[model samples]
Target chain A: MLTIHTKLISAMITQSLKDHPIETCGIIAGLAGSNLPLRLIPMRNVAQSENFFMFDPQQQLQVWKEMSARHEEPVVIYHSHTGSEAYPSRSDVELAAEPQAHYVIIPTCSPHKEEIRSFRIVDQMVIEERVQIVRQYQPELEFQMMVA
Target chain B: MSITVIIPTILRPLTHQQKHIDMEGSRVSEIIDHMDQQYPGIKEKLVANGNAHRFINIYVNDNDIRFQDGLATSLRDGDVLTILPAVAGG
Candidate 1:
């Protein structure tokens, strides 16, 4: 079971959904610590989509290099379903380049139905996992809330 | 009592483009009932005939109601219910 820093990722995803509600996508950068122990950081989102999120090869490489510089591993690649269920389509599984990366799906089927779910897509197979969302308010967001 | 329900982006079309709505209820279930009375097919998407939808989650003041009373979760004045869509990308 993979635990998610719920509030942090949720905020990122909420913004992504609203920003690119049509087809939002991004990358999750974090430590891959395990019994094996992999420490990584400097998470940045490399937003992409199948038909809508094609990034230039150079841009992709740049992001990967950035990840390397930060010692962060590709823990997961997330995108929204956008008016559909949170299950991976055949195309999503076929494009699972990172067997180690968890393919997270954010279903924007209904604004009133905000739910976040994660999955692992490997070898054209989808293995679902539960994520624990731990919300820590960004100082800016906190201040805004306080002021309001 | 009547409270306002905020619908997320994905589910807005179903709500006829109205982002915010007012409904009457003492509990979450009652609010849902009031919404169903206003919009015909809404409750079906929210509560699967009997149980809540597998993909939908209801939050009151940013706290997930699933950890609370499910549909029976109580509501009060000035309370905000944000209907968030389950997002799966990253």
Candidate 2:
């Protein structure tokens, strides 16, 4: 299962709507070993295709290094499917190398009624998981969330 | 001749869970060859048809080998080479 902030979900939906027809991809970074996503990072889709999404190589490296510097890891990897359902395609499964990250697929839809889904794709297997939406993070973690 | 290579998590099994290792070589291709000598089957994951795999991005310091000289990109002492699987899909 995946638990994410409402603000982060809104950010992703806004990004998806703004980049409609062109796939959008990004990651949420959290403290390494924490598994709690605190930062929402929207990446550039270098592919810029309606059906494909690829992060800019340079940007990916920079973000990855920053995560390392901050002792963070990508807890959630997300992308938008403009014309398909919220599910991983065959290619998505074939290319899923992050076995530990939750893969979130959000189909372009009415942001007010979006039904996004999360999955764990490991070794060609795709297992759907539940999503827990929380309005408020722990008071202690709220500071980090605001800082993000 | 000593170059540091950073391995991604997915390929850590081939490197015995080592994410970083010092290798000796003059070119990116040679470094890969040396790594393969130590950890069999890793070369196949990074190279295909005598070229870097399309799904993998290899970097020498801050420069991507694809934008430089592909596998022939020269390496100097203390250069850091990083191998990351492309986060992409259809």
Q: What is the TM-score of chain A alone in each candidate?
A: 0.71, 0.93
**C-alpha lDDT of residue B38 in model 2:** 99
lDDT of 1 by residue, A8-125 (tens): 4655467556744556665655544321112222122334442333223333444554655666556666666766677777667655656667676767667624576778776568
| Model 2 Cα lDDT, one tens digit per residue, A1-148 | 8988888888888888888889989999899888788888889999999999888888888888898889988899999988888989988999998888999988985542357899999888999999998888998776677222
Q: Which stretch of 10 consecutive residues in model 1 chain B shows the poorest summed lDDT?
A: B81-90
lDDT of 1 by residue, B1-90 (tens): 767887744466668879789877878888888887877777876887565664465776666677788888899987877665333232
Q: Judged by TM-score, which candidate is best?
A: 2
What CAPRI class is candidate 2? high
B1-90: candidate 2 lDDT, tens digit per residue: 999999988999999999799999999999999999999999999999999998899999988888999999999999999998889997
Q: Once superposed on the true structure, which residue ranges of model 2 sit more than 4 Å away at CA?
A: A109-113, A146-148
Which stretches in model 1 have alpha-carbon errors above 4 Å?
A32-52, A136-148, B1-90
**TM match of model 2 to true structure:** 0.96
Q: How far is candidate 1 from the true structure (C-alpha RMSD, Å)?
A: 17.9
Q: What is the interface RMSD of each candidate, in Å?
A: 13.3, 0.7
The models' CA-based lDDT, in order, is 0.59, 0.89
